[model samples]
Every structure is written in C-alpha cells, then in structure tokens.
Target chain A: MAKKSIKIRAKVKEDIVTVKALMTHPMETGARKDKSGELIPAHFIQEVVCESGGKTILTADWSGGVSKNPYLSFKFKGASKGDMVKLSWADNKGKSDSVEAKIG
Target chain B: MNLKRRIVLKGTAAASAIGVAGLLAPRAVLAAWPEAAFTAKTVPEALEALTGNSAASESGDIKIKAPDIAENGAVVPVTVTTSIEGIQSISVIAANNPVPLVASYNMGEGALGFVSTRIKMGKSGDVVAVVKAGDKLYSASKGVKVTIGGCGG
Candidate 1:
C-alpha cells in the first residue's frame, strides 16, 4: 500500500519522545449523508500502533466517534534522538497503512 | 462516477486479499477487535465485552482531565493519567454516545499509564476513564458539556 494517509513527527526532549500524528481520514460516522443525501458508510480507523526503537510503545483502538481527520499526541520514555519511530493504522473495513519517522 | 466504481471494486479485492493474509499471521493477544464491545450501546455492556467483567472500582489514582464545557462537540480534548502500577490497558468511555466505548489503549511493558487524545461527543455526558492494572480495573470520570455535533446520537 502507499501508506499516504498518515503524517507523523517525533521529537526527543529531556529523554522523552513526544510523537504527534495527523491522520487524513473522512471518519465517516455512517450516519452522515452525501450530496445526494445517501448514507455514508462507517469508515474509520479502529486501531493505531506506535513503535519506538523496535518496541511497541502505544496502541489505540478508536471508534467512529472520533472526529474527522483525527489528531493524536503522546509521549514515551527510553527513546533518544536518531532513533526510529513507526506508526500504523487499521480501519474498520480492513484497510491499513503505516509510516515511519526518525526522532529528531 | 465511473472512477468511483472502479475504486470501490479495487478496494474490495484488496480487502479480501488482506483477510486471507491476516488468517495466516500468528495470533496475538487483543489483536482482534471485540465487536460486541464496540457495538454495545450501554456502558456496562460495553465494559463487559472488553474486560470480561462489568464492575470497576472507583479510584482516585486515575485522573481525567477535560474541560468543564466543550465548545465544540466535534472535537473534545481528553487526557488520562494514573499513578497505579502494572497498568496494562486504558479505555475511554463516553457514557452518552451511541457507542459508549470511544477509545481503548494497550500499554506496553514499562510504559507510562498516560494518554491524551481528542474524541467526538454527540451530546453532554460523563467521560469515564478506565485503567486495567494487574487484573483489576480502576476508573475515574468527569462531566463534559457539549456545545454541538459531537459523536453519537
């Protein structure tokens, strides 16, 4: 897959790595309508995983209740500058994507 | 549009391929989604599905930070932090949402029991934070009034 849905950044400060991510998703609630007033199916990311330096640090399971184009921020310890951080997401429809970043 | 149909068809094919691949992968704990939990309309039912039990002891150690009044229903900031040890997982429940289980987190070994994120609120209600520590669940909650257009009905 292209993995073009996520934009992530990680920064290390005082031995803590703060990871910020912006996900591009419609987050359709399956309750909304289109231009023609057709119901939009529920298509939202249900799970997100963050790995720092080869160990899973954070994982999130979200429902369609999250807002459109979700934004998330979290911090973790034991990571330093020049380390690797990877993030991946899986949606309700079985679609998945991932992106990697370097701690700056 | 013609392009839209093609995209949907391609997506279906890709989804089936992934379904087959996922079956071959080794099973991991909590890797599969708990459908019953997410679909449960009530708080107790949802918790029961997620944790295998419905009762949670109220604890002061779990701190939930949220605005007293949320100006926008579409985006409400919520933060959860705990002083307890051996924390395994954390879940956020919006009591009034169509689906009470808004979000859940799995903490890794030695990971801090802290999480912050934004969630949608369909209406004003209590936002509960539950932490699973050492086979027991502890929870804290705060009421947040929504202005409009949150998450559920």
Candidate 2:
C-alpha cells in the first residue's frame, strides 16, 4: 500500500473556515540532474482543489517553482464547525492524493 | 501524379481534423490545467497566457507579505492579500526565476482574497502578486534577497 501524501486541517471561526494543507512531493523541475548526471523528469503538482459540503471553494494551479512539500493556506465562508473539507492535488505525472478533515 | 495529389489532400484533411480536436480538448476536460501558461518562460508571456491581457495596473489594494531576505531559497514563504472586491483570482510570480509565474489561485464564491504558500527562488528577485477583479487586473510586488540558490541541485 502506498503512503498518504496529503495532510489537511480546517477550523471554523466566526462563520469563516480556514484551511491549511501540506502535501509531500519531490516537485522536480526536470532541470535538476541526479548524482549520475541524468536529468530528472519534471514531477510536480499542477492542480490543487479544495471542497466543502460538496461545493468547490478554491482551485490552485502551480508550477515546478513551488517548494518541495508545498504548504497552502486559505479561507472561505458558508461552512460551520463539524463540516467536512476535502483537499486534493494532481501532479504532472498523473499521481494524486486527497484527504478530508472536519472543521474544528 | 494523380495518386500523389490524392494523398496530399488526405493528409491535409487529417491534419485539420486533429487541429480542431486540439482546440476543443481543453474545454472537454473541466478545470483542466493551463499548460501553456505554466510552461511560459517570461513573466509577460506567462501573464498573457494566464490572463487574457498582460497589462496589469499597480494598486495599493493588493498587499504582498514576504521576508526581505531569505536564508534559504528553497522555501521562501509568501502571502498575498487584497481588499479588492469581486476578486476572481490571484497569481504569484517570482520575476527572476527560470519560470516567473509560480502559482495561480481561482477563488470560488464566498472565498477570501488571500493565499499563503511557499515558493522556490533561483536567486534574489521581486515577488509579484497579481489579482484579477472583475475584468481588471491589479498587482503589487516586493523584493526578496536570497542567500542561496534553489534551482541547481
């Protein structure tokens, strides 16, 4: 079984829900060379989507310029405590991971 | 001679068919990745591909928060916030990086005009934040000094 790659947290305060997510990825730019001097293929997350209560709230498009183990933070309204928020990301190589957390 | 002309006609038809499909492919996939924009090398080219227009007005409504000096270029924290109403999206561009456009965020209904993330910088440069509101684009930028480059492995 593959290990999970995404960790997410959500908390509601004053009718606003704040979400923070951390994703583990190498985020290779294809410009880097390995110890053997072979060019590493570009492997980076291209899109990240956040949803709450079955509704999409935020969508992010990223390039390889993003740092390794990218961390993202954002906020949205119309959700309350105990509501579920899901964060997902898809890389350029077609790999993806998603995780859900309840608003604290 | 007749067979050669027929083959040329058939090739043209096939090429046009593939061209039409290429134009319609992005729409078929909902929320498809913006490949052209991300792959763009220059800042103006990236902005032009991401937003319809490359011209953006400098505005005080947008705020960019980042360190004046980064000890490590591999993980420089950045946050963009705007008071502009009806924000459609926000994009971060590291002007000196190999690929200037770092990330773009599309806000949904009731979402705030703020985003915080970390980016890699090849060297010291200005970090520009562009906010799209309604049909207008507003931008703000801040300079960050990097002690070590992040791109070279």
Q: Indicate the docking level reached by candidate 1.
A: acceptable
Angstrom error at residue B76, model 2: 0.4
> lDDT tens string, model 1, B18-67?
34334423223336666567777788898999999888999999999999
Model 2, docking class: acceptable
Clashing pairs in 1: B121-B150, B121-B151, B122-B151
Q: After superposition, how far is residue A87 of candidate 1 from its true place, in Å?
A: 0.2
Estimate TM-scores for all models. Answer: 0.83, 0.87
TM-score of chain B of each: 0.78, 0.79
**Cand 1, B chain, TM:** 0.78
Best by TM-score: 2
Q: What is the lDDT of residue B124 in candidate 2?
A: 91
- lDDT of prediction 2: 0.84
- Model 1's lDDT to the true fold? 0.79
